[model samples]
Target: MSWLVTGGAGYIGAHVVRALVDDGESVVVYDDLSTGSAERIPEGVPLVVGSVLDRSALDAAIRDNAVTGVVHIAAKKQVGESVEQPLHYYRENVTGLQTLLEAMASAGVGRLVFSSSAAVYGMPDVDLVTEDTPCLPMSPYGETKLVGEWLIAAAARAHGIRAASLRYFNVAGAAAPELSDSGVFNLIPMVFERLEAGEAPRVFGDDYATPDGTCVRDYIHVADIASAHLAAARRLADFPEGTALTPSTSDAGRAARSGRWSTASSRSPAGRTSAGHEPSVTRQVSLADRARELLGWSARHDLDDMIESAWQGWRRRHG
Candidate 1:
């Protein structure tokens, strides 16, 4: 089956595209190259440069490529920027997805693997957040993701589309130096930038209520993220036709750790020390039980693996 990977040139998207291709699946890349580089896309993979908002472009790519499924990964994902430009976030993340769905429906494409975020459960007060955690998004970016899930669910119910919304936690690392995340918006890259500048990494808000007084989060490897997409895509491809699959929530993350600095310190190439204490924030485990039972999938990489791989990518780009 041919899969159209939207944003296939971006950090995580590029990894997903490679994984799909390595599995011997026919793949096509649809990206605008705004934040993504065309070079990241593997050789021989057809890349259709276009925005998700452009229906004509999306239609042409889907029809021409004979796309049977879609892995929607394109989005404006900055939290702070979403706060400053809520409309743009909604337009790009929410409206853009709507446009994609409409084009997919019109083209008779019925399978989707949506790239969602843990931000939908913003500031969970539980000890371990599961798929049932109540969604209370803290930022516009989070809101857009939550809304995107809603849209997917609605479309699935109405159009008999097979879909899964993978709510990813902190994604880090790289399968290769070229595939490493280049943005400094994430904690790993942010710390790498600070260390490269010969400065101490800043630990944000160490005063949060917890055991050590800093926030805890789950970080997962980018390669694992790509594997998850492949698993989900395969599941949808083989699902019985006309059977409506509810848009279920699937979480993906590593074991929870306290403080961005604590997580960063464990993997810092220079072995830098962290100043913040660990917080009591709820462990954001990705609740992979459903994925395991349904898709027979689970993460294989750990924190050290993620950090070391990410650091290698950082050095490759910065040096």
Candidate 2:
């Protein structure tokens, strides 16, 4: 079946496209190339240079491609920048979603996989967050994401669409040589870039409440994230015939009935200090609870393995 990948030229979107191609799925890419690169899209996929805000463009793409489903990954996603420009954030993230949903309804495409964020949890009171976690976004970026999910839910109810909002954490790693570089907004790429420049990536705070005295986060590998999207898509394609659910159907209704969670082992608490007394910088391994249970997904790359591969890629490309 043909799939529409919005933002297919961006970091995660590009990888998802590659994964779909590798799975022998026909794919079409739609990207405005604001922060995305046309070069990042694989040569075989049909590419449309367009924005989600343009309902006419989206409707034409969907009708032309006979798009069976959509994986919506387009949005402005810089946290600090979102704080600085909240209106633009709302327009791009929220209003743009409105445009996409309307076009999807007009085109009669119902299944969607939304690229959501752990940022929706916005620095949760607890370290490990579940899907049920209260969304208390601290920044405009997070707030817009929360609003986007709500809009998707509303659209689904009103329009007979079913969606999976994958609440991703820090997505890192690369898929192939043609894949794009990690965006400047993400920390792992920033760290790798700084290190490539022969500098130690700065650690932000070393006095956090975690065992290592640094903030810990769920660092998910990009390949694993792609796998989850595919799984969600397949599940949507195989939905039991004649279910009358409209778009308002909760995520619990159409896809991801359960989840799988796995965590990379945390660094030894003993590694908290180097001889210079700097706290050991580390992020928590994501427990793949939802991916495993709901989508039958689990992560293949652990933190150490991901770091090694990222460093290797950086060295090969820049050295």
Candidate 3:
């Protein structure tokens, strides 16, 4: 059974592709090359260059590859950018996904694995978020992800497509330095950008419920996310109606930042004080055990491992 991986040349998507390949699955990569680099794709895997919004392209890709499943990862994922350009976000993320779904249905692709996000929960007051958590997205990017989930679930119910939606949080680290994320939208890369400019990593607000008054963000290894995709893909036959899973580490958000500054401080001249305070405990929003019980998945790397890998990748690409 061949799998068509949309956005497979991008950071996380490439890792997912590698993981599936490592596990001996036949894989095809579909990417637009907008943010995705063709070099990231593995040799011998077919690369389909097109937007997810292009129905004809998707059909051709699926048909050419004899694809039976899809791992949809293409999207515009910037929170601030989404706020400034909501329509673009909707058109690309929402409409692009709709087009893909329509193509999949037409092609008789019965299995789907959708790459979703933690942003769908917005700013939840809960200590932990489960699959059942109410989704009130604050940004257009998050809204698009939530809507994508709704679309996948609807397709699953009506079209008999087995699917999985993984709402992963603050993804850091890489399988290799070359596979590291180049964009600075994420916290680890954003901090690297600030350090490159000789500026301190800024903390927006500190008067929150956390011990150090910072918002929480659960960090996960990109490899673990890839493995979870494999797990969900393997178990898709079990979930006939499609399901949602949250792949997360135990330490999240503000807790991830404040608790692990020491790990980052070891290499930076700005040190632990760069964040403006010594490491302190903070409230964590755990992604509940749904993924564990169902997909048999859990995060493998720790915060130190995450920081170290990200730093190495940043230096390799930028320095």
The TM-score leader among the candidates is: 3
What would the per-residue lDDT of candidate 2 be over residues 1-319, giving only the tens digit for each residue? 7899999998789888988888998899999999888888888788999988998999999999999789999999988899899999999999888899899888878888888876776665553456666678878998888888888887777877877787777766676544535455665556666544555455555565566455555665677778777877777755543222111111121111001111111221111121344343243323446666666666676665555555555555666
- The backbone clash count of each candidate, in order, is 2, 21, 6
Residue 205, model 3, lDDT: 53
- lDDT for model 3: 0.81
Candidate scoring better on TM-score of 1 and 2: 1
The alpha-carbon deviation from the true structure for residue 256 of candidate 1, after best TM-score superposition, in angstroms, is 5.3
Candidate 2 versus truth, CA RMSD in Å, comes to 7.1
TM-score of model 3 (CA atoms): 0.90
Clashing pairs in 3: 216-253, 216-254, 217-252, 217-253, 218-252, 218-253
Give the alpha carbon lDDT tens digit for every residue of 191-264 in model 3: 77767776666665565576666756677888888998999899987874545443433333323744334236
lDDT of 1 by residue, 117-190 (tens): 88998878776667788999999999999999999888887887888888878888899999999888888888
List candidate 1 stretches off by more than 4 Å.
208-211, 238-283
